[model samples]
Target: MEPTRLNKYLVDAGVCSRREADRLMEEGRITVDGRRAVLGQKVTGNEKIFVDRKPVKKPESIERVYIAYHKPVGIICTSDPKAKDNIIEAVNYPDGRIFHIGRLDVASSGLILLTNDGDIVNAILRAEGQHEKEYIVKVDKDITDEMVTSLRNGVHIGDDRPTLPAKIMKMGARMFSITIVEGRNRQIRRMCEAVGLNVESLKRIRVMGIKLDDIPPGKWRFLTEQETSALKAALV
Candidate 1:
């Protein structure tokens, strides 16, 4: 409740981390009391603050929300309204402003989480790959046991380093379910490509312990009480 630094205030507002707050301040993107904020400036906890002209209100207690969206293929996982077919518009959520927790690529589809609660975002994403993300994928060609084992062992997907071990389950001739802790950009596709398989389609079915279950494509629902509690416990 005391006076807080601009960076800390931004973090509390669930906008960004203290370091990112400093960068935004330096970029002249943040304003306090109608003036561009300077580095290390402190807000009196009552002065008005804005980031890119959007007001920032740090609440002592904030209502938390979590959504399980069945993101459709070709929809982007970004808050930028300028983007074509962005998730926010696709979901048409009438609730207050919120952002997606993680991303599901434009070409890929399925369960993606969105929330207004910043603390949960920080807690879950701060650990990065510590959480689980499960996907069902279809490759262009038949998948062999060797390929599955190789994928589980780890593959150098043209990145600077190899990926960590992933859980693999063969579902069909060309279909497989894989779970990974880390989420590099287009990681699943890249991993398959490394082993000479081209991905035809991919769908993320789960994150943490939450699942898409029977949620139809393009529909989203608020996480249930038990689902939310389990997610928090998993993060712990």
Candidate 2:
């Protein structure tokens, strides 16, 4: 095999993303041929590579898997096996290792994407992609025009910058649907708090062009060919 960057190799081996691989290297958990690996190191795929003392296979051609899951509330969006409510254990995918594309807070439930192809992770999560994620949220109080206008305009949510303009539609007295391009930590909830409302429930309904549809909470399904193609195309 041709020489490849260590981080890329780890990603192709399904150990983790390039960013996570870098973290492992920094923590002195990655080694090559009994020597600690360094960031940006390259290998020809012929050397023994180990991550945290476990041997990693050379990058090989493998079938890629994409799945859409209706993540249930309380399931943590982390791949760490030690985490009590990790999403990976909840899915119990029998095929091979996979990681979530983005995160949904433990208090929220909804559509989340998972895949074995590490190459697409950054593409989907990059802010430059401006991929839209839609959610149905219920606040503790009645919806107000001022709140809707503020959300549609933009609201400061304790971030370095205010959130980008969002698409808002009041669904009922206390229920509304919102669409946002940026995914920040507890963003929707923080936005509500910034506007003097408390989020009672938040559920993502769509990610890009993929929808949760009828997938039962805690259950998952493979992405259709059409959905996969459209998603990749949007990343471009």
The 0-to-1 C-alpha lDDT of every candidate, in the order given, reads 0.85, 0.88
Per-model TM-score versus the true fold:
0.88, 0.92
Q: Pick the candidate with the highest lDDT.
A: 2
Reference-based lDDT, residue 25, model 2: 92
Off by over 4 Å in 1: 14-29, 38-41
The residue pairs that clash in candidate 1, if any, are: none
- Worst window of 10 by summed lDDT in candidate 2: 122-131
lDDT (10s digit) by residue, model 1, range 128-175: 978889999999999999999999999998888899999999999999
Candidate 1 structure lDDT: 0.85
